[model samples]
Target: MKDGKAGAVTELKPSRPLDHADALRAHGSSLLLIEGNGKLDKVTVKGDQAEIDTIKDGLAEPVSVTAVGGTGWIAEGKLSYIIGDNKGKDPGPFTLTPVALPK
Candidate 1:
């Protein structure tokens, strides 16, 4: 985006189609998504292609997600919750890390 204005919408082809994306949020140049199968995925788009990778799983149908600093907080359909970090060299995996919220 030049000058903070959105450019043309580009349709990217996912490595594997996200058939059950419940929640999606943009993180930098990538897109973070929660699928209906209780999987948290990080999607990176480049040109007309997008790659998908599982971050954290075994959730209870996550419905929402938000990223604070380098941590991501997910709402798992009111049953349980999970958290993770930006997984160093590899993007996914999202190992759990301690987080401090604002008052």
Candidate 2:
């Protein structure tokens, strides 16, 4: 993993599943746990738009993510994000629960 001006670059290999929580910790953050079967390729949030990489069946694509109030986010039928509460600092440890959107 490498961090650049844009963001962090992580190489994903099929040898093992990536641990979301560990990934966040590497960036000085915390992610509780993801609770769903939806496969995520990548997630990028800019302004009000969140670009999420989604994988369905065996195909992968990119889609927009929608914020749900101030605590959650949804990408239609692809994925859902439940933002964790930060006690104080903005960059503090927080939980990120990624659940699958209901069909």
Candidate 3:
């Protein structure tokens, strides 16, 4: 995650396509919900000392503001962000394996 101007970049590869709802439940953290039709296919970090990596179909791009607060998940083809109104809503069973970063 990026903090202010300086940010630390980390590569994360999910074992499988994670369901949006399941991700939120697993992370147990609140997220912001936005609305938009922009498709995010790749992310490249550029700079003199930048550590760049490619993210494919990991997040839905051009997120528009649709709600205030909610949960987020990284799926196979797209990222999912649901509003808080969906609280207590079960999205069924999902599997998520921990991804180890390169040392």
| Candidate 2 structure quality by residue, lDDT tens digits, 2-63 | 36456655443332343331111010121222213434333344444433444232211113
Q: 30-103 in candidate 1: lDDT tens per residue?
A: 88888877777888888998899888777655677788887778764532233333223343333342222221
Worst 10 residues of 2 by lDDT: 21-30
Q: Best by TM-score, which number?
A: 1
> How do all models score by TM-score?
0.65, 0.21, 0.22
Question: Regarding lDDT, does 2 or 3 come out ahead?
Answer: 2
Whole-model Cα lDDT of every candidate shown, in order: 0.69, 0.30, 0.28
Off by over 4 Å in 3: 1-48, 59-85, 97-103
Q: Which stretches of candidate 1 lie over 4 Å from their true place?
A: 1-6, 78-103
**What lDDT does candidate 1 reach at residue 35?**
85
Q: Using lDDT, rank the candidates from best to worst.
A: 1, 2, 3
Better of 1 and 2 by TM-score: 1
What TM-score does model 2 achieve against the real structure?
A: 0.21
